[model samples]
Each structure stands twice: as C-alpha cells, then as structure tokens.
Target: MSSGLPAGVDLTNTLLILGGVGLVTLLLRALPFAAMRYFRESALVAWLGIAMPAGVMTVLVMYTLVNSTENPGGIGAALIAVVATAALHLWRRSATMSILFGTVIYMLLVNLVF
Candidate 1:
C-alpha cells in the first residue's frame, strides 16, 4: 500500500522530522523551568506562578465543555463531570483528588450511562 507521502519523504526524513519535533517539544517544556531561576524574584513571575495554573485550568475546562457540545449524547456526562470536579475541588481543595475522581466519573458515565 502506498503511504501517500510526497516523493523523497522516506524513513530517514520521517525520523528526522520526528526527532526535530521531539527536540522542540522538550525544549519548549524545559524552557520555563530553565528560566524560573532568573525570574524567581520578579513580581510578574511571582504573580504568574500563582495565576497561571488557574488560567490554564480555565482554558482546559472551557475547551472540554465546548468540545462536549459536539457530542450531544455525552454533554450531560461532561457537564456532570465538570460540576463534580469543581465541587470536589471547592470542597477538598485537592487538585489530584478532584481530577482523578472527575475523570473516573466521566469515564463511567460515558461508558455505562451515555
């Protein structure tokens, strides 16, 4: 079967492409930690350290809710999971607990009820 890749894009090129992507991703992930020492005392960095997690979580929740609408049947389960997650977070103030329970709830609902 044909791969449909452009001519000249063979295994070597694919490996190189993947390696480049992996290197870029690794660097991107490590860049923030690497720069943290330099920005340790900066006010902006301090504020971001406190704020970025909430901002990122908000973005993720919005993305999940928006995407859930695309699958009509699963919307209820998604909403329930989000609500349960938020409530758990508010109640227990544990990120790990909230996320784990929320995921388990979502999976169960999707698999069994939805």
Candidate 2:
C-alpha cells in the first residue's frame, strides 16, 4: 500500500517529529507567561512595552517607503497613505481603524489611481 509519502519517510518518524515540534511550540508559548511574574516590575520591560510600538511603526514605515520606490508610482501613493494613516491615528487614536483605512487607501491607489 502506497502511503503517498516519500521514500524512507514512515508514519512513525513523522509522528515523532510532529510531537517534538508541538512540545517545543507549547514550551515557547508558555515561557513568556511563566516569566512575566519575574519581569513584571522591571523597568526595562516597562520601557520596551511603551517604546516598542512606535519603534516598530517607524521601521515599518521606513521599509514601506524604501520598497515603494521600486514601483513606477508607488512612492506617492505610499506617502499619501502614510499621511492619511498618521492623521487618522492622531485624530481618532485608534490604531486598528488607522491601519485598516490606510491599507484600504493604499490598495485603492495602487490598483485604481496609480
């Protein structure tokens, strides 16, 4: 009976590998919750919690700007989307709405306007 798997790739080995991966994934997922109590009051953790969002957003914007230059008219659309995203975020203070609207505007510009 052909199991449709590759040669020498038996079910037992596959099951073992999957089990090991599942165990590792569970350990990694639980590690953060386990260590949170120890780092709960740490100043560095608090600082990261506050600064990471802006730092990540800045990196994403820079990456977008850099990549947009590759397309014929992507830079202008990217800039307009970025401005609209910033304005929306500033005015509404909702990250979800700002990001969603920014993505919609960028898609529209790239597909239809640009």
Candidate 3:
C-alpha cells in the first residue's frame, strides 16, 4: 500500500508545514490588534488613518484609468465608474457607498456590457 502522501510529497510533512504557516499567519494578524490595545495612536497615525483612504481611492482610480486605456470600452467604463463614484461620494459623503456603487458598475460593465 502507498503511504498517505501526495504524488511527490509526504502528506504529513505538507500538513505540518501548512499548520505552521497558518499559525504564523494567525499570530501576525493578531499582533496589530494586540499592540493597538496596549498603545495609543500617535498624531501621525491618526492623520494617516483619516487621509489615507481618500488618497488610496484616488490612486486606485488613477491606476484603473491608466491601465485600461488601451481599450476604448475599458476607458469609457472606467470613466463612468469613476464619475459615479465621485458623484456618490459628493452627494452622500460616504466612501462606502461611493466605492460600492463604482465597483458594481465597473464589474457589470466588464462582465456584461464591455
């Protein structure tokens, strides 16, 4: 009988490696929360928290526009999504709503229309 192993690798060894990786990932993810509980946020951190979202959104829009410019439909779809996102954000002042609407429009365009 064959060992309980993959085609080329031992299953037990692979599972041990996977378990170690999973544990390390879990610990790393928890580290930020643990540290936050112990330390107060600095002014720089607070400012970044407030400003980074808008900055990141702007970068993402620019990236999408630049990357999709090769195809006319892609450019048009991206522009429509960007405008919709901006309008939603302006009207409601909610980033969540803006991003959600924009993402939905973009996905629909790419999948069905464009």
Q: Evaluated with lDDT, which candidate comes out highest?
A: 2
- Which stretches of candidate 1 lie above 4 Å from their native place? 1-33
lDDT of each: 0.87, 0.92, 0.87
Better of 1 and 2 by TM-score: 2
Q: Give the per-residue lDDT digits (tens) of candidate 1, residues 2-109.
A: 578787778778889999999999999999999989998999988998999889888988887888877644679889999999999999999889989998998888
Distance (Å) between predicted and true CA of 1, model 1? 30
Candidate 3 Cα outliers beyond 4 Å, as residue runs:
1-3, 7-12
What is the alpha-carbon lDDT of model 3 when measured against the actual structure? 0.87
* lDDT (C-alpha) at residue 79 in model 1: 93
| Residue pairs whose backbone atoms clash in candidate 2 | none
Model 3 poorest ten-residue lDDT run: 37-46
Stretches of model 2 off by over 4 angstroms after superposition:
1-4
| Model 1 lDDT on a 0 to 1 scale | 0.87
Model 3, residue 11: what's the lDDT?
74
How many pairs collide in each candidate, listed in order? 0, 0, 0
Q: Give the distance in Å from residue 107's predicted Cα in candidate 3 to where it truly belongs.
A: 1.5
Q: Name the TM-score of candidate 2.
A: 0.85
Sorted by lDDT (best first), the order is: 2, 1, 3
Clashes of 3: 0
- Ranked by TM-score from best down, the candidates are 2, 3, 1
lDDT of 2 by residue, 19-81 (tens): 999999999999999999999999999999999988988898898899998964579999999
